[model samples]
Target: MSSKFAQNRSFKKNCTAFAAFFIMSVSYCQTSTYGQFWNEVQFNRTINAKWSTELNLGSSYSSTETSSNIFENNIQKSFRGWGHYYLSPRWKISSFVAYYDNKDVPEIGQFKSPEWRFALQAIYYFHKTGYTLSTRMRMELRHMRNGDDDYENVLRYRQQFKYLQPINSKILRKGVVYGIASDELYFKSGTKVTGLSFFDRNRLVVGAGYLFTDDIQLEFAYANEYLPRDNENQIVNAASLTLTFNNLLPNLNKKLLHKNEANTNED
Candidate 1:
């Protein structure tokens, strides 16, 4: 009886999240800045408890302002890869690079330079609710060209606060369902000396996650973004999907835990 009740509750929560996302998408789609739609998938694998890596593949399209039609733009392909390391239980760091190749759409015209970026990041963990809470900080160097001109160099900082809350504790023995949300702010690293403005971009995301096991999880969400190049009044909405796999090194986590326990015992 209790198990069935919990399942019912989980279903309600999932439906609520989806409904809210749908409403937000519809409400925002009416504006000129809102026609950009995106779908993406990501994979993450752990080399061990201490090291992990990621790959993300995605595509995006935007409607022409004049036509205001749905899904009218050509697809933009993206590739991203990163590696993360656990320094300790509470701290970790990552470095990543990404590339984007956007095809010519009548509305946006051709962009000469494919955009690419390299960044280093650090995350601090403070809480665990089955779904964890953490903050991430990153510094990025972006390389891009709009035309025949030289590549513009921009240094950016991004800070994000994230929450992951589990829905069904009983079911967590085999799998778990959770809610996740995060907000990120971007800032230019320098202003007077670098001649770059302080503000750059911002992003907000909300979604739910399901963990099939400690080894695998998937997340689906909606993202709203404010880009510096786009009109200030416009907000771009994107759909996001991510998958995570852990323990690629098999017994490495167990070995590490055992080793740590042994060290503590000796002390």
Candidate 2:
């Protein structure tokens, strides 16, 4: 038991050191910087006993420095939605589709058709610190407007960790404030891609959230993304505001019903 515990400690120490290095490099060691502000609204809700769904809407404003003009302006508009089906106690499957409209991007050009992606993912859930930690593995296929005659092919692998720590102990109450942190590292492989490093980018975000009952949530966060290029590494700084509403129509119906009941009582 002593030997096992020692090994676990060593492993955790190494992992923590690596994560710190990655985050520091991204936030401080990049060039040709940009600023991005984003807004997102998302929902995740359970359906029946074995299914769930997610809906997301988001947009962004970005500006980068270039010699041709003082600073190039860009905006991104997007939507993402997915559905989940539980297959067992610890495993599930998800299908997701997303759309993006980005301006002044090198990959998609200044003005062109929007980009689209479809993905299928498998998720495994585990318990840690009395909370759930999810490991999601996904594969995506993409379609975009490009000069190439064939579609772009890329494979990505990402690992994300999320945790919510409650500030209130009352189970019957309708509100709770929690802190959350998530980190994701990305890699890509494809036919038309060329890069010196197989590991491309890293993203880290930390923030607090407020949950009002089971219907709504609000979160604000700061995010940093590292992009590797041939000449230099680039860093994009972002601030985000997110609002999530679960079962929108159902929640509205419940409010209306309560209002009608109050009127009947008065009569």
Candidate 3:
């Protein structure tokens, strides 16, 4: 297990180095939409027979449109705290609150416009495996505050439908695993000068992981996203790695069996 995990770490480091070199060598024109790159620290704790909680914290830095002529480096920090309720064997309900920021770093004395989004999600499981279908509705409030510019209340609605399928090993003990996901995002309020009038953003991600033990899984992924507006479109390519430690590993097997029995009884 340790050897497999070490190999996975080596792979992640190599991928990160390649991505960094590729981006620095080229000059990107137009707008770039980068997917989140920070490592995720997530743990799941079962509270009772029907309730569970997930906590996550992550951060990322990327390049974005600075102004009309230049580009500014952007950084985003995301913290997520969510709860899941098992309504039935195949049905579940989850909700999360996320904070996002779009900051301008080049301009002197420039402030940041942070956005807060609250989302309620519903998920349906296919079987004992990880195959699932998810629908999410997010209500967003963007507070655009700057030292030089004053903007009004930005209210937006975002809805997404996603499908998740496992691409790696099915056995948890083997450690090497992958999940492929795709989603379509719809935006209501147009952004500032980017001239975005209701765009379609589609994302494809491949998550690869190697488990060190029942308690720890080290993961890496390559993701791409395309957002097309009326005339202009933004393209993004991002790579990231995460190390997940399952604090409640001793209970996972018991819970898995319980979850399986629940599904069987429902069936």
Candidate 4:
């Protein structure tokens, strides 16, 4: 009983510290704020015991002060492909290539060209009794055209800490609901970056996810992004929704076969 009490106390203390950090990071910048809505769909496949892949398609819409609807204006569309190799159950390394098609927004004008980005990342997971904690580090190389129509090469690094807790069960599984919280910081340096501060942005996300089946999961999250520019800092409040399908091709084939069998029996 005493050991259990000590463990509970430690958990509470950690939670309190995390809350304080998240609040401070979000409040660090008070500037022009806008609203956005983001939607994403991901398809995941596992090839072998140690290898997996993912493809993602996403889009975002922005809202201005004068806009009647939050998702009134389309701002960006993106596609990404990722390959992952698991070193162990608790560690994974991944690389991805992404393309972004950005449109002109009232707050930030159109870019001279769209962006192509490549990133390498590693994630380490710590399994606890009823929850999991993860840390991810990513390095990104971005290629884009600057405002002056000059090609720019940017290097950026990101660090993220994420926590996951199951709400009604000890482990996350089919029909399970889980809560997630993550904080990420970005730092950048590039030829086009003339800002004195290398600190690019911070993103804080809090959300919940539901696993409908072994192959499908859906998540909804609220993200707070703080970006500091040379002149004016900006904050974005975004509502994000993501849907993931695992083992997409195999699952689709199985469903199709099942349907056909049912139709034949009916006939």
Candidate 5:
């Protein structure tokens, strides 16, 4: 009876959070809003008990109400690589470098220059019986060439709160479906940011994921973005999809070697 009651409480809490996120997203549509779609593919490899790495490639597309097709315009393409070290089961630290080819501005011409970014991140996890909560703090250094062909540098800080709950089991594992939600805030500081506000933007996401196997998973989510500018604020309603592969190459190689050994024995 106690377990059943707890499950009911968890469900209610999740429903409430989802409802609030949906309402906020709807309210943002009253402003200068646009629609976007982001797709990403990630590869993860575990090097040892304390070390891991990830590579991610992603693209973004944008559309306005008058646009004929939502995906007709490609706004951004990016690649990022990360190296992680585990301090313990509950803490992790990482560093990453990223490159972005941005074509979102018509005034600047398409893909005229690119952005380079580097970040350091730390995460702390709170483990509960049925769910996990975490916070991530990241600091970023961004470099890009301005219209005058001079290099501009900016510093940004980001903080995010994330929650994960397993639907079918006590813990997240292979073949389990899970619910996830996160909210992130961004802040900017630098000489180039003199005219802009210190508060950069906010991103909120609500999503679900299905673990197909130990090596692969897929996630789909709705993301709401609010960015404040000097003249007009921008709102983005985005759909995001991510596919993750774990130890893909190593697993495939192992299977191939096993098959070859079997063939040799048969001969």
Candidate 6:
């Protein structure tokens, strides 16, 4: 009952945040300044020593105005499930199925985009020292529907490279930092579209994370983005706090109690 209540509260909180985001976005539609906020709730489990499954729920809201009279706002909500399989100790393959919706206008708002994404990744690890080189190739199946218009399906691809380095190891041990660079390419292949052209989007991401224990972790990340559709570059700031459980959730203070008992036995 307590767990159910807690989940209900969290759902309500997320809804409230989404509502606030919409309000703020609409209100700032006529200004040059823009703001966006996003949140993600993720869960993952190891399917085997080399395979894993991950689930993610994410929401975002953003607003911008090209001029005093022209305003644009965006709201997105997505849920994704993915499977990751390691080909080698430092190389992996990933496939994902996702359902996403974008809200563009207030009157007849909502565009559905269900996509399937696949990726291959390579990671190079340094001996003893905490560092890694990461590279990836990504492809996606994009289904887009706008208002009453017929849906269109398309294919998109991206290539990315990143460097991961350890930052701090005390208190929050396993602290690491990353520098990422990515380029996105789109392929227009469908029955409903005319001219086919490639659009490129670039991003830079930097972040740090810590492993509190084997079962718990926290991370914060920030990104800068450039999209071909928008004339002005955008900046994104993000933060996350995650809790990972191996089998089931454990009581946080159980280790302290066990340590006390062991000391008593020793005395």
Between prediction 2 and prediction 4, the one with superior TM-score is 4
Query: Candidate 5 at 165: error in angstroms?
Result: 1.0
lDDT string, candidate 3, 1-267, tens digits: 999999999999999999988885553333545434555677777788899888787766555454332123446667778888999987788887777564642211235756565666676555546555666565555555444465534555656655555456554654545564546565656645223466545666666667776667777877677766444456766676776655466566778999999999999
Local accuracy of candidate 2 as per-residue lDDT tens digits, 88-117:
978889999999776665323345446687
Off by over 4 Å in 3: 1-36, 64-74, 105-111, 128-176, 191-196, 229-232, 248-267
- Model 2 residue pairs with clashes: none
Looking at model 6, how many pairs of residues clash?
0
TM-score of each candidate structure, all chains considered together? 0.68, 0.74, 0.61, 0.83, 0.83, 0.61
Q: Quote the lDDT for 82 in model 3.
A: 85
Can you tell me which runs of candidate 6 are displaced by over 4 Å? 1-33, 66-74, 105-128, 170-197, 230-267
Superior candidate under TM-score, 3 versus 5 = 5
For each candidate, the alpha-carbon lDDT, in order, equals 0.72, 0.72, 0.62, 0.87, 0.85, 0.54
Shift in Å, residue 123, candidate 6: 6.4
Strongest candidate by lDDT: 4
Better of 5 and 6 by TM-score: 5
Clashing pairs in 5: none
**Relative to the unseen true structure, what is the C-alpha lDDT of residue 164 in candidate 6, on a scale of 0 to 100?**
57
Candidate 2 Cα lDDT to native? 0.72
Model 4 C-alpha lDDT per residue in residues 1-267, reported as the tens digit of each score = 999999999999999999999987766654677899999999999999999999999999988667747688788899999999999989999999999877754333545357899999999999899999999999999886666766678888999999999998998779999999999999988355334468988999999999998789999999999888755687888999999999989988999999999999999
Which is the better candidate, 2 or 4, if ranked by lDDT? 4
* Candidate 1 residue-wise lDDT, 72-179, digit = tens: 765578899999999999999999999977565322244535668899999999865466789999999877544554566668899999987778873343477888
